[model samples]
Target: MKKSNQQLTTIKTLFLGLMVLILTSFSEVAAQNDPVRLGFIPLTDCSPIVMAKELGLFKKYGVEVVVTKESSWANIRDKVLTGELDGAHCLYSMPFSVYTGVGGKAGSEMMIAMMLNVNGQAITLSNDFCGKVGFKQMNKVTPVVAAKLKAEKEVTFAMTFPGGTHDLWLRNWMSIAGLNQKAVKIITIPPPQMVANMKVGNMDGYCVGEPWGGVAVKQGIGFTQIASQDIWKDHPEKALVVNKEFSEKRRTDLVKVMKAIMEACIWLDNPANRKKAAAIIGKAPYVNAPADVIENRLMGNYDLGCNQGTEVYSNDYMLFHKGGMVNYPRKSYAIWAMAQYVRFGYLKEAPNYKAIADKLILQDLYEEVAKSMKVKVPNDDMKPFSLTMDKTVFDPNNPAAYLKVVKR
Candidate 1:
């Protein structure tokens, strides 16, 4: 009887050990699928992440996400760098800038996992400049700025961050219009603070993301002189980015996040859904503006409010998803940015464009998620995009030549 009891106890011990192993395996899987924390600035371009969370799209893809509204781009960059956040709705070129050490930390491995949206930003001129020059009349502003310089005064402009898309757009516009970028003083200001700074006469103009630009117009302090699309139609704007470590360790979570965002992007592109997008993102904790303020401009109904009245751009405006390859992380877009950096003296010498783009774009990851989500992507990653304002065709294959022809 004692021998029998000992055998029974051994059997019980084996069963408990097997159960523990099974529970451990389950716990490991559960830990691998924990909630993803994502960050975004309070801007219209952040609609993808916002929509995903709001619509339960993130959960729908078997991933839980918490979207945090950050104070500035710098904060977003730092948190993502330190692994405080899993990913973020970031400036399209920010990851590249960080990687190549132009305007951010040098050699920080980052990836633009998904292209979020395009053409939502604009350059707004303070009311002071409105009396002199108006919408799309970039040629007229030169004389006014020249006069200001003749008076020995500084004409200041503000962008969100250095070596960011806003900076690139502002510099590109100034360069294409023959304005000396060095002659004008350019500063960095948070997107939400743009209008207030202009009101206090701290800045003459600013290039910033949407809702804020529209907010400036509504406040009667400034008018948008140029939509970013006018400079380069359908240019790549904000992106969803993650560092290499997170990508390597938690690719499954990243794929789920991308799927959720891709669905949101598709929804945003639909005209029927844009009103809902405006309403959702315009709430207090998101963009903190009225729905009308974000909705009208978001749908391409532009009212400069600078005595120019309103203009309609329709499908050519800010698009979350359009054309066949709107969200594809094209290497060309990345290459073109480097070319611009060289032209503007931001970089003394051009880095290997293809190599940097390949590292930073995360095309394979995007396409992998796209395939799983049944979203069709381009067969080739490279695309030939044009810069109409400069009248120069940027050959991504030869970014070096592209930079040589651009205004220095």
Candidate 2:
């Protein structure tokens, strides 16, 4: 009887061990299959992530994604750094800014997985300057600003974030138009709050991504002064930014997500599908704006208020995938953005542009994903490009020389 009991106890131990192993394996698999959480600020540029989830592209690519609508850019940066978010629809210059300590902690690593979309951002001015400055007539604003400064009234302007794309655009406009940056107060305002702040006469102007620009015009508080593309035709605006750990550890899953977003980008570029996309992203959970407001600018139709009449941008509207050109992460673009930081006094000195660009931008991974998707990558790195507004040529190969010649 003693021998029989010992054998039964050994058998029970073996069974329990086997069950533990099985449970552990199941838990590991479940953990690996957990959903990737992505965050986005409610703007039209966030369409790629939204479309990816809504169109079931995430599942099609064999990954789960939870899209969170963040309230501000600072929140997006914090959550991404803490691993609370896997990735985000972020400003193209945000990671660089954070890494360099212009926007966040210096030396923080945020990787640019790929470019999400270009253009579709704008600078809106209050009705105070509506009659003074019309679309693309940024030169005319200098006089009004001078008048304001002469009157001892603070000439306040706002951008979505410091050292961000909108900030650079607003600064560039001010520089070219000869407006004194020091004389004007440039504050940071969240994209959604731009129109509301303008409504209360809090700011003279703001630079932000759509559909807020559209929203501002719709509310009759402001007028579209200039589209971002007009500043630099097809300029890089937003990106798919991921944490360093997520990019390194979950590389395959990141590739899947990139592929899915790229597919959504292709879909978004299709002119016929934009109306549907606008309707979907404009919902409360996404951009939370009027569908018509989002759709108008998405289709390249701008109802520029202040009697400027409507203008159609046939070629330079918000581009998601223009034959895959818009999706390629160009290091030259990053170089230009960082150079602008120095040019506008955001950075005290120039950064190691090539090293920073190569480190932060995951070109190899983007190439891998692009090749898998049969997408053509553009070979336009380290080349000189000109802005449409000022015709200032930026030669990425020699950023220092370009910086020397450009007027601040």
Candidate 3:
């Protein structure tokens, strides 16, 4: 009996040891696949990153992702530049700006793994101005007419950042309307505060990304003068930005991050997910607006906030899913943004825009990630598309001439 009891004790101890070994192995694997932190601003189009985390797509691909909400684009740029962040959902032009040293302390080679979204922005005019101008929709009135009417008035307009996409869009929209940028007082305001500032009569008009513009309309503070899609169809808006050094050192991890986001973008673009995405984004911590306000527009329903009734716009607002169009990073998209930079005096000369775009966009990396995930990448990553304002086709092969024609 004593021998049998001793044998039993030895067996129990061995079983316990084996259990510990298995547990330790799992813990190590989990640690190895720990989340890569991603930074983003609080914009509706930031859905892919947000939805990826919410839906567990990141985990499904053996990645742990933590999404950090940043207050401003500058914060997003600075954090990524200083290595405080692994990557970010950033302005499409931000990587170019950082690489060329145009904004935020110069000479940082910020690279974009993919263009995450496009064309879901708007220019809003205050309701007070609507009453004064006697126009039902500010967007319908030509900028030349608007400027002539408000020439004597200050006609203050605001953009989210000085050297950001919002600024360029606002300037381009005004120029197309025949408003001299120098004549109108252009101010910079953080996007989140846009609606509130306009409500308090601090500004007459503003151009900003969605949810904010939708929120402004929802609050009866402003009306949509123009959807950004009208200014440029499927214009590149935001991207996943990282420092070139980090990308080089952590290439595998970078590819994983891009893959995860690409999956999230796919999920977001689904028509069925629109309501759910708006509900998810409308939470106080995200967009901080009514779900209806976000959902209707997110699904391409636009009201313009003057009770003009909602209209179904096309797929101008993108979250990257659908037919493989979103993940393919285009060098032409980056170069077009650079052209705008030069047009607006943010860049003195072209600054080798093509070379810089090629360096930062990483189309090859995007293709590899798509292939590994069995996602189809478009054969032509870059295509020529014309904008309505100048009716100029942006040929990637002839960017210099394209710029010259646009300037003329």
Top of the candidates by TM-score: 2
Regions of model 2 farther than 4 Å from truth: 1-30
* Lowest-sum lDDT 10-residue window in model 1: 379-388
lDDT of 1 by residue, 75-117 (tens): 9899999888889999888877877787677888778898988
Give candidate 1 regions above 4 Å deviation. Answer: 1-31
Write down the TM-score of every candidate: 0.92, 0.93, 0.85
Where's the lowest-lDDT run of ten residues in candidate 3?
A: 131-140
Q: What is the lDDT of residue 49 in candidate 2?
A: 96
What lDDT score belongs to each candidate, Candidate 1 first?
Answer: 0.86, 0.92, 0.77
Candidate 3 Cα errors over 4 Å, as ranges = 1-34, 131-152, 381-383
What does the lDDT read for residue 241 in candidate 3?
A: 85
Clash totals, every prediction: 0, 0, 3
The residue pairs in collision within model 1 are: none
lDDT of 1: 0.86
lDDT of 3 by residue, 1-408 (tens): 999999999999999999999998887566456567788888888888888888877777776778888888888888888878878888888777766666666667778888788778888888765644322243544553456456666668898766678887888777666565666678878788888899898888898888888888778878887788877877778888886666876677777777778888877788898889889978876767789978888888888766555656876654465666766778877777777777777777777867887777788888888888888887764668778565778787667777676642
lDDT: the better of candidates 2 and 3: 2
Ranking of models by TM-score: 2, 1, 3
